[model samples]
Target: MKEWSVLLLSLTAAAFVLFAGAGTASAADGGKILIAYFSRADENYQVGYVEKGNTQVLAEAVAEATGGELFRIETERPYPKEYRETTEVAKREQNEGARPKLKSTPPDIGFYDVIFLGYPNWWGDMPMAVYTFLESYGSGAFAGKRIIPFCTAAGSGLSGTVGTIGKLCPGATVNNAFTMLGAEAQEFSDGTRAKVREWLVGTGLVK
Candidate 1:
């Protein structure tokens, strides 16, 4: 009976070691994450007069799920508070290929192994400020890093922004993008969070 008891104890210890090793392996594989996004508050499409922009809400949920650091991308000159006026400004910026000046210095992106970029889809593309943010880092900063994009849009979804990121950061591994309606993100925050968590799990960012 004593020999049998010793054998059971040995099996339990082995199981514990195996499980612990797996947890460590998972943590090692999941590198440090950073959630950087551009969001605008005020009169927005669908959800009007928001203090927190739709993209900001979504980005915050992503940060919560992945435990990533949050960085907001703001322009030196704010966009119009009115939705129509903002769209016009966005269109002009895109037509001119303009790079709006950023309001703050960017974080040291070299410290993060994974970067989750979020923005609101404007005129079927990322806002011009996001362009400035990416270009500010220079192409070399993103080399060998994993970039995952998410967006809140009216109807454009990701609007092929994932491909654009690949073009901009050629050395970085750009993963598939996740997108949701701005209204859904703004109005149904709890559901949005759940969906974001599920998507993160599929992307291997969360378990």
Candidate 2:
């Protein structure tokens, strides 16, 4: 009986040490960055598909700045190709609180320590696909990771989407967000790059 108790005590001590070590690793040295973004590539508002989506451009910049892994949060069923049609559908989804099915997820999702979540502002909210990603692994999907939001919008800068993320990802360490105009992203690459770099540095995720 005494021997079993000693073994159990040793196991408990080992688990505590391991848990403490993981906590320290989470905030250490930009810790395994993951840049996850949802972008639409077809006919967009004002900016036609010149090759890439506005949010995609920002996602790439974030990956470059932080050496983060990129994960595109895509829908299994595609959205409408026309901008107006897509917006109409988006509105309905937002009203219904829809969770569209996703195409895929990162194989090593739990390995990421800092996640930079990017999306376009849709009806003052994130794409329904983004919610799918957040809820994919059940509750606490973003637990123990620092979540930094970046977004592109024509006018509605973030539109309180960051707060919505906090609601979705209950235990996530959600931080202040970065917002850029979609038109500016398409028209001014240099300026957008500078802004992305500045935001990454300000977040202390990149030097």
**C-alpha lDDT (0 to 100) for residue 81 of candidate 2:** 85
Alpha-carbon TM-score of each model against the true structure: 0.85, 0.83
lDDT, candidate 1, residue 71? 95
Candidate 1 lands at a TM-score of 0.85
Q: What is the C-alpha RMSD of each candidate to the true structure, in Å?
A: 8.5, 13.9
Screening candidate 1 with a backbone cut-off below 3 angstroms (N, C-alpha, C), the clashing residue pairs are none
RMSD in Å for candidate 2, one decimal? 13.9
Clash pairs, model 2 backbone = none
TM-score of 2: 0.83
Give lDDT for model 1.
0.85
Error of 1 at 174 (Å): 0.8
